[model samples]
Target: MVLVGWGEQVFRAGLKGRGCGVDEGLRELAAPFVVPDPSGVAIRTRLKQLTAVDEEVLRRVGAHLGTLASGDLKARCHDGLAHDAEAWATRKRELTPLSSARWAGAITRATHEQWALARRCALAHLQSLQAGVHALRHRLSLPLGQKGSKRAPGGYRSRREWHAKARRLRVLEDRLARERAAWQAGRVHVVRGGKRLARMRHQLPAAQLTELQWRARWEAARWFLRADGESGKRYGNETIRIGPDGEVSIRLPAPLAGLANAPHGRYVLTGRVRFAHRGTEWADRVAVNRAIAYRIHHDPVRGRWYVTASWQTPASPAVPLAAALGHGVIGVDTNADHLATWRLDVHGNPTGNPRRFPYDLSGTTGHRDAQLRHALTRLLHWARTCGVRAIAVEDLDFTAEKTREKHGGRKQFRRLVSGLPTGRLRARLTSMADAMGLTVVAVDPAYTSKWGAQHWQKPLTSKNRRITRHDAASIAIGRRAQGHPLRRRTTPPRAHRSDVHGHRIVQAGGDAPGREGPRRRLPGPRTRSVPPDAERTRATRTPTTVRGVRGEQEWVPDSLLLTD
Candidate 1:
């Protein structure tokens, strides 16, 4: 997600709704491409069709899709199928298997798409192919759209986009090779990077298909990617699966959001699976439409597939989220120290508000990040148990890397959060929620903690703000160090709260002794959210007791209070 300035008025509005026309179109496209008695042709034969039977021109395109990247190859095929339902009926075409002309049209369509992409936007060209495949499955598998065709969208610029994409692609390639080498040895290096990027690496070992598809869809989305790092998002009840074998596929229909003019809210789902059948076991042809998506034939070396196509024509209405949205919302306050939280009921009242959970590690603070993480996880687990579906958190400033506090410890923390990486909490939360079928909503936590009740806010003045409060507000008149004998007066934030005989008392400062010299006033109260580059909130040592009043206690650890 791109981060605009805070004052830019970020509205969490959904994209314009559109009926799944593309999906329907794809499903319809696939309906005629399916072949019953498939004659699997060799990959070489498929390559020969595009090039002459001789070895010269065919070598230019390369034997596989991977080889086609460098050279300026034209995918000269049909932009789309050229068949009308009425015309087909008039021609008395059978509804069963794909005909020779139909197969030719498929190749034509592939060629046309490739050509279209080359001239305008390379990314869009790629995105369309993948989205076409995705939309096809959605429409075919489930009834997803009413008879409709929204304005077919175009792709974006592919030049600068490809450079950035290529960099990442190369990085992915290097990582994959290292992983493969490590994997073959039975044990792998403890990858100290992202689990999702890692898992994504494993799911798509070779970057060819995924890489091509990513660029393609980015082009399709008009160069806009879904916020929250999703190129395309799936909302309602959709479950994507990868077979045990290295077959890449997803069943659309339910939960696949942001589709061909598909409206917001929820959808029952609709779409069909499409893939190229490349093996000579089946005659070379583009196939589409059927329950499961066709993986077609794959190459062992390039890890590419051909003879596959995506089906469309799925349709469903958007529905309300019965469990995911309506139940309750869990608001997580991701902190630099710990994960503070407050659970709100349906009416937006704080029902189960818990003080900040202890997420600070003894030696290293970054490792304690897992505590906040685990706390969020526990909250999710609780939400799951409590039947609360959606979790809400503030949108974090994560697009750019920000400096962070160094968490110590040789092993406890390790690379858990070595150099701060302030964006970990929300990132992890969203990802975990995705796997658990939970919906996560991001809100603006602009002034939640800064603006509190009078009882919570009355302690920062020079005088004891709590005049009616008990003796806990006392300052032990102690002397400054050295021969300079002097009476010192100051109030200090102490550790260990006490409520003896209805009188509140606490130790001044924390675990260690007072300063070596006289003490200057400590920092002021820190704001809820830390400043991006600089520390925003000031720290203060004034003690606050809310036993009879708000009863909300500020739990600054004894550590920060300790004068080192």
Candidate 2:
């Protein structure tokens, strides 16, 4: 517990406060890494008295945190882009330099992605502005007309009328001219900034520009990054430098560096083997061998430390989704609190009764997550039992559409939308399904409900039991993913219907001269004689089921028979 608390303090200080690095000449600030002894006395040892194993742990923690911080920086840059887009489009405002203080500390330790993230956002914003200017100019260039102007009394019959008409046109023309000038000026300024950036690139080395000058140039010329190609993105040793023998190190900012007490004012950190297990231990093999990076995580409830090492490996070839979709697909219709599921064969025929797995989310986050995990476990087990290879799910996203204002601006609607477990469930499902070797296919959710209810309810139902609307929808989702038609022949054949109604009657038979029946036979060709009522109308346009040419042998309903 003491070691855990000490590690936590060091991690928090480095990530939230002045960031730490892995180098020599360690900073010697009052020792926040100091852990209290069993006697409750604070022990100050500059963290050097700790075993080499513990020191390595601290270093890995710091480096791992720095990488995660880069994610934060990327998010901030993207958010800035979104805010700028809204202001420009809705408020007619132009782009401006972001607050330097907000990004001051982050810029110093920016990763390759962080730099690219900012540059791309700035370029996109400038391009949007240019597009707006072009649209405005096109609107202004239309031939002058009295279409939108109020008609003058007497209509140019007198000097006063003519004067009034001319005056209105002039006023409108002047307003347009002013707008054009403002837009053109903004364009000129942005272009000029791009030229300046180009000049700097020629004058300075890449490293020099990368370190201190790029951010300045980006701010001065809002879209200067357009000149550079993303293929040149730097990673690996450039961003995260690791020495020979797996000695990882990073350069800390001044404030964080001063917190350690190593000689030469540098703080160096490394990876150490904690416990070995048949030469397959985490620190022995995982951390030191082919470790592209590491991630640190803490479980507050367990009070333990965990480091996940990422390794670079050759990509494994995966079977194509079509080939892997072996027997059939399991369609999962995700609702607010339950997953409605059904299975469909390759021919789009429902294989079994649908299932509903209910999960409760009325407690803490951990409790809700547990409930979801249990539900998914059961679902995947069922899929495995049925020998299903692919799971079809509706590609439903409510982030942008499920808004309070859209639902009558009610507070309850807003809360409900916020509480939806779509994101977590989708992520968990994808990961777990992949591990189980099940391919997940996302299908369009358009009209699944209406179409399913209209076409499938009666056919998929029995006299004693009927499938719910959601279960029918699940069937639709699976068929769509497999490229099968949704609607199918549902009504029984005319003869079958007659039999069911207990009103069957033989039709008056017609034996044509060339037809083949007990009474008539043709010499050249023979055809089966049909009753007058049984004979199908050749000109009747009712659609009937036709087999598709695909390997799945889909049943395509006759379009003429099916209503929209």
Candidate 3:
């Protein structure tokens, strides 16, 4: 009888609705490739020791620019699909009187980016709706309680479920239609202060915030104090310039120019700033007057002001896969709470003990981000210690997996999938690894966990070293990245075993002498015997065959045999 383990059953169940094909319970896997280096870098620092006058000037400038930006965004949205270069120029000209030419340029650029982002988001939503509708229709078409294969989900389990799913299908269809219409019309829904924050306005008590605090946060979030860089300009920025000595100055709007503390209608803060991280790179860029964009924003909860400096870097040449795997790799399996990692050699063999770097993803967003960064820092340090030049990770995207329609009643599983931080982990790890002179290899995430458990889990586990499914998955990931098979090498067939077939495990190379010959005999007793010469004695005195011809043999038959 065939026995199925609980883990395997769970894995098979999870494959439902994954759009798997009929191919031996396997999904198409993408070839592994080295992830390219990040094309941009951003470093942030806080503005400290600001005077009351400085705060007043900053607030005034931010508020004035925020109004202009809001108006520009509104106009851009109104233009919709009909927007063009002439319309963009007209908007910038209108804002130039209220703000400076550079400020107008920044606002227009930001508005265009935000609008484009909204359009992309709308398209994604439409796609998601279409997927939901398709899945619901397929499942509803099947008979109730019908079993599903690994390739697709079956019908609902009961009449109640079927009815409920039928309602959901209609709702999804309606949503899909609306989203498709909006997409075709080039209309997108975007909120300036964020849709989540906008909704929090109705539940201030639930959010544990007073009306005044909410208003402050709202206005702070909407403020636009960003400026793009011009290579020929001072410090590579014209509007918001930070000198080599950390002196920050902003070109105030035309109306707010009267509040300028510095010459040329510019406002210079009493506070200075320094980026603790990537300070040398930032300084190098500033010294040479390379283009660097800057953004000033306020954190209402902390009541602190901060400035971010960002710049684009030239794209690095893609490293060949062979070169990246020369020094082996560290495969990392990202989870909701911790990272499961294993170091592997270039031959795709696990080199060291499996390591787990645990991080708490609870609390605020900043806390979660810090936790992730701290965990990754430890991982990178460990990788460097291992002398590996590449880190392998599954190219995971939980976008389709996180939907309620796809996962159904598995709320916990859905939450776990949604909380894996796949995108953030990839981005952070790629940027960090690039800085550390390491490459990241993203392998197909198709069946890492399942195949790892089946082929690697038990074999690698022992009393002293216990390998979890995630650790096994890390091994599989590393192997996959290195172009190795997931499953272990099969043993030789029974007909190819023992001395008759020469070797039991490995076959000799064709160039090997006597490659097809039987194994050489060893000088020892085959079993518990009288002496080591038993083979010679048996060969010399083992004539047990009786020689009898028909004429010479006596015809002696027993009486009992005759009677029978």
4-108 per-residue lDDT for model 3 (tens digits) = 222223334443335343345455668998888999999999999999898888888888899999999999998899999999999999999999899999999
Output the number of the lDDT-best candidate. Answer: 3
388-424, model 2: which lDDT tens digit per residue?
Answer: 8888876654433232112222465456546767667
Q: How would the candidate models be sorted by TM-score, starting from the highest?
A: 3, 2, 1
With a 3 Å backbone cut-off (N, CA, C), the pairs that clash in candidate 3 are none
Model 1 Cα lDDT, one tens digit per residue, 1-564: 421211111111001112223442322111101001111212221211221222221121122222221121121221123334453343323211222222222233333344444334433233333443433333333332333234222221245543453454455455545544533332312211223344554456464447555443322222110011011222210222212222222222222222212233222112222224323222111121122222233332343223232222233232233344467655454443454444545554445324355466445455655565676667678778767666655443322111111110123232332333445565666556754667766433222232221222234233533321111011000000011111222455444233333322233433335623334343356633333465443332223555434435886898898895
- lDDT-wise, the better of 1 and 2 is 2
Q: RMSD in angstroms, candidate 2?
A: 26.0
Error of 3 at 18 (Å): 7.7
Instruction: Give lDDT for model 1.
Output: 0.33
Segments in model 3 whose C-alpha atoms lie over 4 Å from true places:
1-25, 494-497, 501-564
